[model samples]
Target: MTTICVDAMGGDERPEVVLEGIAAALAADPELEVLVAGDEGVVGPFAESHERARALVTTEVIGMGEHPAEAVRAKRDSSIVRGCAAVRAGEADGFFSAGSTGAIFTAATLGVGRIRGIRRPALATALPGLDGHRTIALDLGANADARPEMLVQFAHMGRAYAKVVLGVEDARVGLLSNGTEDAKGSELAVSYHEALAAAGCGFAGNAEGTDLLLGSFDVIVCDGFTGNVALKSMEGTAKYLVKQIKAAAGESKRSAVGALLFKPALKRVAAELSGDEYGGAVLLGLKAPVFIGHGATSATAVAKGTAACAAAVRGGLVDGIAQALADAS
Candidate 1:
């Protein structure tokens, strides 16, 4: 059975949405168990109603604006800290939070700890892909800068995630660059490109910004600053395009009729592009599974994130990445 510890006090909606999400997840999976960590005043009653969940009271709460590491250290009884401690102590298989991204990352790295050979943990997210496959991109704001060796490590980490969680055979890894040429981008990208090419891990050379949503590669690697910018750009662009499509469809009676006819197709496309279905970002290279959902995530998104964390734990994601690193060594 896979047991996950959740920081119930995290996120904008607090225990209400978290409890609703936990209820939904428990209803969906009979084998899953959850340890809800938060103030006993809130989480205790909710846990009592659920058969598969139990509450672990935490006295302190970490605010979003506080310094991540300092807040984690000072507020040892915070939900986020307690949840991570649960994983470290072997009381849970994974940890999930819709908390401060930096705080969650810091707690997971310092509390649950990193895998044996991981230099820095990378934040990876699944992008919509063709043929029902999701492309996994990494270093999404975990580290602002990355060395060539670190980029190589990110490739291996991403490839393992793609293979184990995404079920992609022979996952193609791409380095994000300005152009799909050998001699583009900064010295960092140039050196990283050469290193990835010689690393013999299905390197697909450089991928420009346009190739991100095209499903051109199974995994895309880049520095955190660049990757985060690209991610936000794609998100904003997707939203803009969706709005344009809706406006265009409603502009004319004929267009409205056509849209009604194609409503199902449009719904499918919207679902595919929706960030809620992606279940939040996974913090790879950690000793145990750690998922960081958006602060404004809905109950459905929280439920999906919980399920994703359980799947990663069941899939032996950490072991797969460890073995991949061992092989490369």
Candidate 2:
């Protein structure tokens, strides 16, 4: 059985949602083995009560809200650290958490470490654009700032991730900017675009925020600061649009009838727009696969994230990344 480690105590909702996710994951993958690291007393009972959770899980509870590094050093018992340790020790094939992004990144960097020659790890998230095209964006807050060289590295990393994970061959990489012209972006974007172009990457010119939904490129590379802002903006806009649609539907009987008539189709469309439907973002460039789920993730979302991690392991993503970096170096 492929083993997966989960930070059972992490998340805005804490043990309840995390536990719910774990239980749902176990239910979906009967052969999957889970190592839950959190407060044992709390998580054990929850896991035991669920047949799939109990049958498939092993437990080790750690403290909640402890400083990440200190907890990693001192609280050999903190959930995030323990989960990373499990993956590092080969007890788990991958790690999943809806925990503090800072803690997860810190613990993983220290415990599991980066792939050879990778300067730093990056967070990669796939956002659905127009035309059923999914655009993958990288450095989504892993490294708030990046060098031109780092952006070049991100291109290679994003390319490989899109290829293996998203099954997109000949993935196109774009430099995010305010305009399509080479002169339109910041100094870094212009320099990086030139560097990427020269580096033999499939660099598809500049893509503005407006082009984000146009699917102009398969991968978009930017420093985390820009990427994070873009991500939040998109998420907020999506939420607002959904709220507006619901409100509009509730305004009159005619709208209510229309909502019922199109409810199934609307549900399908909503699922596609939801961030969780893409599973979760991958913490690429690490030695082992790590998926960071949304803090408000439901059981289905967590289960899907776990399955994505399993696919990463089976597809040799970590090893592929190491080789790609080594070749580029």
Candidate 3:
């Protein structure tokens, strides 16, 4: 059975949405098991009633605003910490949290630990693309500051994740830069461009921001700061476009009537554009899969992230990264 440790008190919508997501995940995957960590008062009855669930009662909760490292050190029994501990202790195969990104990243790195020969683990997500394409991007928010060599590692890691999870046979890696030309981009990007190319980890050269969804590159690598900014910008732009479309659709009775025919397609596109397509970002270069969802994630996202984690575990994500890193070295 593939087991995942869940942080029940992690998200904005506490135990309720978390429980609902767990229920949905359990219903969907018969062989999946969960080690839910949260307050006894909240998670006790759910664990007792569910056949595949067990609760790890926690007295402390690391609030979203609290300092991640401090909370992790002080609140040893926090749900996030306990969940990572569960993974570290071999009680669970993966960790899933819709909590503070800092907290989950800190706890997972300090607790469950990084894979061998990895300097810094990165956050990656397969951005859904047009024409049935998918491009994987890395260092979403794990490390804001990274050296050129780290970009090399991110390239290899992104390539491996795309190959294993996205089923890309020969993942092409791209360095996110201002222009496709090697001479373009900041000093770091130029240096990373050179280092990534020399690393020989399928570096396909520089890619512009517009190329993210174009599927020209299978993997996009960058520092966490840049990647995170790019992701949020894309999300904001999508929301704006959706809002405008809705406004346009309602401007007149004739248009609204026409919109009725395409509402279903619009909804699907909105869902895809909302950045909820993947539900969570996969933290690569770790010993186990640690899925970090948005703090305000919905029940759908919770379920999707949990299911994705289970799939990653079954797909040998850890083994794939290890093999990729070994080969790169």
Candidate 3 residue-wise lDDT, 16-61, digit = tens? 9988998899999999999989999878999999989999999999
* Lowest summed lDDT window (length 10), candidate 2: 54-63
lDDT of 1 by residue, 36-155 (tens): 999988789988888989998999988878899899889989999889999999999999898899999998999899999899999999888667767788889999998888899999
Global lDDT of each candidate: 0.88, 0.78, 0.88
Answer with 1 or 2, whichever has the higher lDDT.
1
What stretches of model 3 exceed 4 Å from their correct place?
A: none
Better of 1 and 3 by TM-score: 3
lDDT of model 2 at position 61: 36
Worst 10 residues of 1 by lDDT: 267-276
Candidate 1 ranges beyond 4 A from true positions: 246-268
Summed backbone clashes in each candidate are 0, 3, 0
Off by over 4 Å in 2: 46-76
Per-candidate TM equals 0.93, 0.89, 0.96
Shift of residue 252 alpha carbon in model 1, Å? 4.7
lDDT, residue 20, model 1: 90
Q: Who wins the TM-score comparison?
A: 3
